[model samples]
Target: MGTFVNNAWYVAAWGNEVRRELLPRTLLGQQILLYRKENGEAVALVDRCPHKLAPLSLGELKGDSVQCGYHGLTFDCSGTCIRVPGQRNIPTEAQVRAFPVMEKYNAIWVWMGDPEQADTTAIIDVPHYGDPGWGLVDGQYLHFKSNYLNITDNLVDPAHTSYVHKNTIGNAAGEEVGVKVEQSDSHVLAYRWINDAPQVPLVERMGKLAGNVDRWQYYYLHLPSISYVDFGCIPVGTEPTEANKDRGFRSFSFNFLTPETESTTHYFWLHLRNYHPDDPQASDDVARLMNQTFEEDATLLEFIQREQERTGVREYARIAIDNAPLRIRRQIERLQSKEQSAEAAAMDCEAETAIR
Candidate 1:
C-alpha cells in the first residue's frame, strides 16, 4: 500500500463506469467500492468491512446500502453501519471511512484526503466540457508502472513527442523552434512555436490541412492534476507571426491526469474542436482516427514504464525543450513545502490550545 498525500483529488473512474452495482477501485493504494444509490447518487466507501475486514465490493448492494458478504453486515454510503443480521442493534462503533465523490465532465472524482477539506474548489476547471459548438471525443484510461511524477514530466515535455511519437505526431526534421515558458504560484504554461515546414506524412496525408502553416502549441499545467494543450494553425496566406493574435486556432484538448498510486495513473481527456468533415460518416471516421493516435501514445508510455522499472534508475538528463517538465517539478516541490509548513503550524496551534 502507498501513502496518500492529503488534500488532493484523484479521478476514480469514468462516471458511466459506476452504476447500481458495486464497482471496486484502488486510489492512492486504498481499496474502495463505488456505486450509485436508488436515486442515482454516486457514493464511495472503504472496501473493507468493519467486522471481519472482508472486501465490501464482493458484497451485494441493497437499496442505498451495501451488505458485507462475510457476515451480512450492512453499511450506508456514509460508512455508517446500518445493520448486522441477527444482532439486536447495530453497534455504534461499527463504521468504515467514506470519501467525498462527485461526477464532473463524465468522470468520477474522489477526494482521497481529509474529508473536512474536500470541496468543489479542489477540482480543476474544464471550460470546454459544456460548450456545444465543439465536437467532443472520449479519451483513454491507461495504467503505468512508473511514478505519477514521471507521467507529469512526460506531458510537460513537448520535445519527446518528436522522437517518441515520430511515426505519429513527431516532426523528425522540423526545426527546434523557440519556446516561451512561464510559471506562477498556481500554474505553468509552455508555448512552442513551430516554424514553416513541409507537413510530415501523417499530417500531410491525414490532417487534410494544406499550404504553408506554422503551429503554435501551448500547454497549461493548472496545479495538482490538470493540463491542457491549445493548438493554433495559420494558413499559408495568413500572417504566420500574427496568427496567434488573430485567434487562428480552432481546436483544444484537456487532459486530467490523476494518480491512483505512486506507480499508476488515470488519464481522462476531452478533445474539443469545431473542425469536422461535412459527411457524418467521415466525421466519425476522423474521430476514430484521432482516437487511434492517442492509443499509440498510451502504448508507448506503458512500454516506457516497464523499461524504467527494469533499469531501476531515476532522473533522466533533460534537453532545452524540457523546460515544461522542469517548471512543473519546481511547482510540485513548492506545493509540498507549503503543505508541510501548514501542518507544522497546525501542530503548534494544537499544542498551545491544549496548554490553555
Candidate 2:
C-alpha cells in the first residue's frame, strides 16, 4: 500500500451524518470520533481516551463535552480534559488529540496531520454546486473493500468501463476509442471522445437522441484520490466546445475517496446535472444508475485487491492505458518521500533541543 498523504483534508462523513449524537468512524487507519456541537459546529477527535484508550464514541455526549464511560474523563470540543471524576486536580496530559474539522459542500472534512498546518482552503472546490438551473444529488456514500490507489487507477482508466460496466454506462462502441492523458500539478486527466457513435444505454434512456451522437468521457483524478467525471452527449459533428458540451445533455459526477484502512476505502459522491434540473424522477434515475456503476467498480477492485495481496504484487505488467495510473503512483511516491524527510528533520530538531 502507498503512504497516505496526511496533511490533506479527508471527508469523515456527510454533514447530516454528524449530528448531536457521537458518530464513530475510521479514516486512514485511525479511529476518529465525530459529532456536531449544540450550535451546529462539527468536531473531530482521536477516538481513544488518554486514560485507558477506550473509544470516546462509547461515552455519552454531555452538551459539547464527551464524558468517557470508562472513567468519566470528560473532554471538551477542543479535546481539552475539562473534568475528571473524583479528582480536583486534572492531569495536564489527560486529553485526546483534537483534529481540525470543517463542514463544507454538504460534507464534514477532517485533517489528519499536524493540527498547526490545517488549512480549510486546501479542500477542493466543486463547480456549479449551487448554481442556478442545475440538479444536485448530494450526500451519497459507499464502502469499497479495496486499496484507495486501486480505485484511483480505475477512475482514470475508461477502458475498463466497456468490459466491467457494459450494462450500466458502457458500450462496445468505446472499446476502440483512444484515450489521451494530461497531467498538471494537482490532477491527472484521461479523456476521449467517441465520435459519431450510438449512444450508450444510459444516454439512450435519458437523452432520447434521434441520430448518432458524439459523446465525451473525461475522467479527472485529483491528487490523493478524488475523481470528477464529466459525461455528456452532443449532436453528431457538433463543435466539441465547453459551452456546446454543456448545451448538450451533460452531468458532473464527483467522487471523493477517503482511505479507511490499508485495504478499505470510504467513497462519497455527488451528482450534478444541467438537464431536467427540477425533475425528481431524473434525480432518482441518476442515483440508481450511478450507484450501480460504482458498485461494479467496487466488486472488481475488491477482487484485484485480494489477488494483489496474495501475490505480493500490485501489477505484473504495464500497458498503454496505464499512463495516467503510473503518473499518479509516481506523484504519490514523491509526496511520501517529501513527508518522510520533513518528519526526520523535525525529529532531529527535537534531539538538538533536548541536548541543549
Candidate 3:
C-alpha cells in the first residue's frame, strides 16, 4: 500500500558521480552507501553498520571494504562482515544489506528488492545512444521537490507544454492539437503532431528551419520511471516516415527519474540529437535548453504538489489527456499488488517448511 515500489531499478547516481570514497544517498526511502572497489567496480550497501547502527559512510574505505568508524567492523562489497577488529569469530548477524547494482548508459542503477530478480535485461534500451550520427548530452542531473509520481504525470501529459515550456520547448501553435495515447505491458505513450506550423523556439535555434515545418512529439513513459521524448520537425509534408524523420531535425530526450524520498526525486537526463552529432557546442546548447524546459516543469510541479497537500486533493478536474497518466498509475498499483502477493506466498511457504 506504499507509494514507493522497491522491486524496480532506480538510478542512484551517474556513473561518474561514484568514486572510491564513500558517498551516502537515499533511494526509495532507504539509507544507502555507494562506493567503488579498488578495481573500480561499483558497490551499494545499507549505510548502517549492524553493530552500533552507525552510518558506514562516516567510516573509511579500507582497500575493498568499509571500516565502521564507531566499532571497526568491516564489511566487504557483498555486505559480508569480514573483520570484527577485536573478535576472532564473526557472528552470522554481523552483516549488512548489499543492493544489486548495474552500470549502463552512463548511469548506475540500484535494485532494492529481491536480489534474484535483479535482471539487467529489464533496463530500457536507449536507441542511437552511441551512434556516430547522434550527438550525446549525458551526465546531467536535477533535483525536484515534487513526488516522482507527480513528475511522471507531467511527463505523460503534453498539454502543459504550451504554457509551462513556452520559452523553451512548447508554443501556442500546438495548444489546439489533440494528443493520442497508446500503451503496452511495459510502457505508456502520449503524443501528437502539429502540421505546417512555425518551428518552436527550440527548433528555430537548433533546427534552422527557414520556413513552416511539420513537427511531432512522441512522449513515452517506460515503467516504472523512464520518460523518453522523441520530438522533431521536418519540412512541411516531409512524409513523416522514420527515415525521413531522421533526415530532418530529430532528438531523443530521456529522463530517468529516481525517487529520493516519497516527495523528492533525482532526475537524471541524457539527450541524443541527429543534428551536429560531432559538435561540442551543439551538446552544450541541448543541455542548456533541456534543463531550462525541465526546470519550468519542476517549479510548476512543486506549486501543484503544495496545493495538493494543502487541499488533500490531487485532482480537481480530469479530461481526455488524463488517459495516459491514469493508465500509468493503474499499472504501478498492479505491480505493487503483485509484489505483496509474492511476499505473502513466500512467507506461507517458509512457515510450511518450518512445520514439516
Candidate 4:
C-alpha cells in the first residue's frame, strides 16, 4: 500500500491542536513535531533530533525553539541547531528537516516533500465555510485501521450505503440506481439523483419537507485523498439544481484523510448545513449522527483491511459500480508516477551538473 503522495498538502492537525506545547504526529510515515510560536505561526520539524536520534517531541519548548531533553541540544523553528550546551560550536550536520506548513480553513496543512514546491494556493476550498447562512461542525476526528485508498474507494462508492449505513444515511430506494462518473484534471465526481424517494431519517427530522423528495448525492474525491459529500433533498419533482439544493435541505460533509502509516489514516471531518443555521441543537445532532455514521464505516473498513492483509488480495472482483473508485485509483497512480519521474529527472540533472 502506498503511504502518500509527498508533494501534496495534507492536513497535519486542526488549527487549535497546535499550541506552544509540542505536538507529535505522523504523516506519510514521517514522524513530525508540530507547535505554534508565540505569534501563533505554526511550525513543523522532523520529530527526531540529529543527535542520538531522540524524538524532539520528547523535549520541551523554549520560546520559538525546542530544547532536546537528552543532551540539551536546542534547535530553532527552522530546524537549525542553535545552541549546543557543552560545545560552543554547533555541528553543521546537527540540523533536522523542517516541513513547510500553513494554517488555513481552521486546519494546519503540511508539505512533506520539496519545501520549495509547497504551494499554499493548492489547498482545496471549503464552500460556504464561514458564510452567515450556514452552520458548521468542525474539528471532528476518527482513526481508521485501513489503508487510505480503501477509505477513498468507499467514499466514491454510493452503492454500499444501502447495506452498510441502513441506520444512518442509507435506504434501499436508490440501491439499483447507477452512479454517473465525471472527472477533471484534479478531481473526480460520482453523483446520482434519487428521485421521489422518502427522506432518510436524519433529513426527515431536520428538513422541512413532509413527503418524498428528490434527493441528490454528489460524492467528490479531490486529488490524492480529500472526499466530501454534497447531499440534500428538495420537494419531490423539483429540479435538482444547485439553486434548488441550496433552497432545500443541504449539507457538505467534508472528510480530510491523512495517512499516518501504510495501514492507518487520520480521518478529520466537518459538516456544513444550510438548515437550522441558528440552532445549536441542530449542530449537536448533526455532529452526533455523523460521528455515528462514520464510525460505522470505520468498523467495516477495518475488517476489510484485515482480510486483505490476511489473504494478500486487494480485490476479488470488479463490478459496474467500481468505475468511480477505479478512476480515482488510476488518477492517484498517475500522480505518483509523474512525481517520481520529476524527481528522477532532477536527480539526473544534478549528476550532470556535478560532472561539469
Question: Candidate 3 regions off by >4 Å?
Answer: none
Ordered from best to worst lDDT, the candidate numbers read: 3, 4, 2, 1
Residue-level lDDT of model 1, residues 6-79, one tens digit each, is 57777788878989999998776789899999998899999999888999999999999999999999998899
TM-score of 2: 0.98
Q: What is the overall TM-score of model 4 with all chains considered together?
A: 0.98
- As for TM-score, the candidate ahead, 1 or 3, is 3
RMSD of 1: 3.3
Candidate 3 residue 326 Cα shift, in angstroms, is: 0.5
Over 64-163, each residue of candidate 4 has an lDDT whose tens digit, in order, gives 9999989989999999999999779989999989999989889999998888889899998899999999999999999999999999999998888888
Which residue segments of model 4 deviate by more than 4 Å? 1-3
lDDT at residue 161 of model 3 (Cα atoms): 89
Q: What lDDT, from 0 to 1, does candidate 4 have?
A: 0.91
- Clashes in each model (backbone N, CA, C under 3 Å)? 1, 0, 0, 0
- List RMSD in Å for every model shown: 3.3, 1.2, 1.0, 1.1
* Root-mean-square deviation of candidate 3: 1.0
lDDT of 2 by residue, 1-356 (tens): 35698877888999989989989999999999999899999999999899999999999999999999899999999999999989899999897889999889999999988788898888888888999988999989999999999999999998888898887778898999889999997899999989888777777777646678998899999888889999889999999899888888888999999999999999999999988889999889989989999999999899999999999999999999999999998988877787788899999999999999
lDDT of 3 by residue, 1-356 (tens): 55777788888999999999999998888899999998889999999999889999999999999999998999999999999987799999999999999999989999988899999999889989898888999999999998899999999988888888887778899999999999999899999999998888888887557798998999999988999999998999889899999999899999999988888899999999998899998889889999999998999989988998899898989999899999999999988888899999999999999999
Give the clashing residue pairs of candidate 2, or none: none
